[model samples]
Target: MVGREETTMFHRDLHPDGRPVKPEEREQLLRKVLPPTSYSDETTRSTSPKPVGRKRRILWSRFVTRIHLILFAIIQAVFSIYLRSRYLYHVIIDRIYTIMYYPHRTPEYIRRDVKALSRLPTHISVILDLHSHDRYDADSSLENLVNDVCEICAWTASAGIPVLTIYERTGILKEYLQDTHRAITQTLRSYYGQHPPSISLRAPHLQSISPPRSPNTLPADATPPRLEVTLISKDDGRATLVDLTKTFAEMAQNRKIGPEHVTGELIEQELSDLTMKEPDLLILFGPNVQLQGYPPWQLRLTEIFNVEDHQGVAYHVFLRALHCYGKAQMRFGR
Candidate 1:
């Protein structure tokens, strides 16, 4: 016999031998086959397209972040330059400051603002509306009224402004003679200590509203003017106040005294004289007080704040008034 042929099959060369193989022979043939796989080692270790796409996304995110930072830096540089220049001063100081107060209650914001104003050299004025009986005290005693005045004076002094507390009731002053006189005198002394001649307390000359004689021919009881008033809306009142101011300017220019306009002793003696002689500034607070019996004559040249009594007297209001006064041009109607 010819020597038996020993042939091994590769996995891909499993073609038919033209006869069924025995189980043992099939097993031997399978064992002779090698495992099938791709030929390139580099292709097997290569990164997938999904991972490459993620890397590109991360790089794009970094680029966007850099652009935002660059824009923020540019904006900061522009703001810094603006602040460095004097252009910001007008915005800081250009405003009319004013405040309103209920007769005796002081708000906390007012105190904070007062502390702020004390640091500055600006002069501020406060107008107070003190109710004599029902408002200021539960006991309706003169001592309470006097105490209220003292408190107000102290507040104004703290803020660096002289207090000009006005009351419609001359009776309140007369009633509180013992208490108010001492209180006011003490306030003046205390205020002058801090501000020297910059501070003073003023009470306008009281117009005598005495009862008429003759019971049979007695006049009807005169109703006191309203302590509260709603100043015409700011727009309307501003125009009217401006017009009145213009008229007063004309009068001042003429310099001739008119009989119809009787200057009250309070207006002539206390406020107008002082303001005109000093020619500094008068900031009227609580313009809604009707100014009915106030220093109406002086208000013409004065920078009237005319805030509502409900506006609550506070430090911020005064600051606003001072700011407005500072920015306002004293044309004297040139």
Candidate 2:
């Protein structure tokens, strides 16, 4: 009756192609005809940038973490290599020097080396690390530290370094003073027979040792010592200062001297009398540069020397320190 009602899927009967379209089928058709969501989805774009920024931050953090790990590994590797190489270098050089100077006991040879230096220290300070008798020190005394002290004393005396201050951290050297002096005498006798440098051995706050002459040597004919040896310990470094402070306070209370008179010069003079003078050169026997609680007040203008990776004390190291001192120029805060 209406010119054959137009039969087409668009008819208002609400059936898409003879049946209602399923939700999945409708979504698929829409997606196929629609543009990319990234370009057309304006409502979701603000949250989209948020996710992108978050992702970028996560990537950046990961990158930085990786870089830090890489740098740390490189630095650690370099430091390890440097330590190994440094130790090897010192060992080889020490071996060569030992061979060249096989016998270091010749007095003339030592003197000649000293004479070549531009200057020599009058007072030399030595830091000794404690060592025990073992296969390494079979030729030395069972008391290795004592033996080292005696050897150093002999070397200093031979070098004409009159004032030698020996600092041992544990004060073990103080216990073996007698043995050390005896050994030093023998070593000096080897260097200068019959006229070994006279040594006056004393420790801080203790009386100078005046023992009976050894059975083999002459009794005192009333001659002063050429070498004045002082034994100081960690205690002497700080305790001595505390003692001086108490002494000054006691004196001030007694009206003996005013606080104004307790100046640096006065304190220095008192210290010089109590301990040895501030040394012109300090020789550390160890490889590292550790002061080991040396008297702080005395090291204000001192020159310090050490050999890298050196395990033990040796005469050549001592000699080399002296040579270095000769080549140095002291400003003293000019």
Candidate 3:
């Protein structure tokens, strides 16, 4: 039962073949089987030393990475500059001239750059309502209105653009014209009779009025009275419309009539008139802040501009407006 004991050897023991265990041999085996404790020291002492240029190669790779980052930044900057130059050349300068020379296009001039587009004309017509002075009432200052008109005429004449005035009603036109004539005479007398630009007030051909409605107008069982629109034929449809908004305001203030009643009446009258008149465009001014029941039918077809400040109506603004009209696309809700 007693067997021979198995032999055991220390790490420094000789091999079973009886060769002495060399330190180099042991270290070589350890180097292959285990991670290095300190590569710098161990590698320096090794018999087969690493190539001397290995450190230099690693440094060269880092330098190459840095150079690549710098080149990428420079390329990005050059691309940005090229794109900006292209936009300025193609969209801003080139397109503006092309738009200007296009055929069948009317030129509108603006004194100030109201729109963001880069190109437009230098002269245009402007029809404006005189808000500084009252449009209605027998006692308001017709002289002030005339002065404003004179300024507008001078501006238009200077810009080589034609201008026109529209009357909301015949009665208002007649009154305005009479007062304008008187104002011209007075100004001439004061300034030694100088001839001023000939200004005229235009009126729609037909005036639509709501018929007086009573219980008898519609039977008790019948629906309430409704407006019967009458069509009138006319040629001078593009006259500048003047709304007597101030008059209506005054009337409402005095309780002579409700604002709704006045607005309704005006809307009825103007809608019918405008359908026949067929104005080219609408210029809203004065106290006529919300179109004020004026020419709804014509308005659908007309381009509108609001100029509440009568004194600020410059020739340039008028020119720009005309230019805008020239450039407008009239597709009718297409």
The 10-residue segment with the lowest total lDDT in model 1: 224-233
Estimate, for each residue in 193-278, the C-alpha lDDT of model 2 and write its tens digit: 77676788899877776555454565557232478889998998888889999999999999999978999999999988887689
- Superposed on all Cα atoms, the candidates' RMSDs to the truth, in angstroms, are 19.7, 10.1, 20.0
lDDT of 1 by residue, 1-334 (tens): 1112324223323334645456676566555453434534445557435777899999999999999999999999998887566444532432323214321323234445544432432333334444533564645644555555565555544444432434332334544344454565465445434222222323323222222233343235521111111111122223433554566568766975454463555334433323321223333444354543443443555555644332344444555665556567779889
Clashes of each: 14, 0, 11
- Please report, as a residue range, the 10-residue window in candidate 3 with the lowest summed lDDT: 224-233
**lDDT for each of the candidates?**
0.43, 0.79, 0.45
Better of 1 and 2 by lDDT: 2
Error of 1 at 162 (Å): 5.7
Which regions of candidate 3 deviate over 4 angstroms?
A: 1-141, 154-163, 167-173, 181-276, 285-289, 307-312
- The full ranking of all candidates by TM-score, starting with the best, is 2, 1, 3
For TM-score, the strongest prediction is 2
Estimate the overall C-alpha local distance difference test score of candidate 3: 0.45
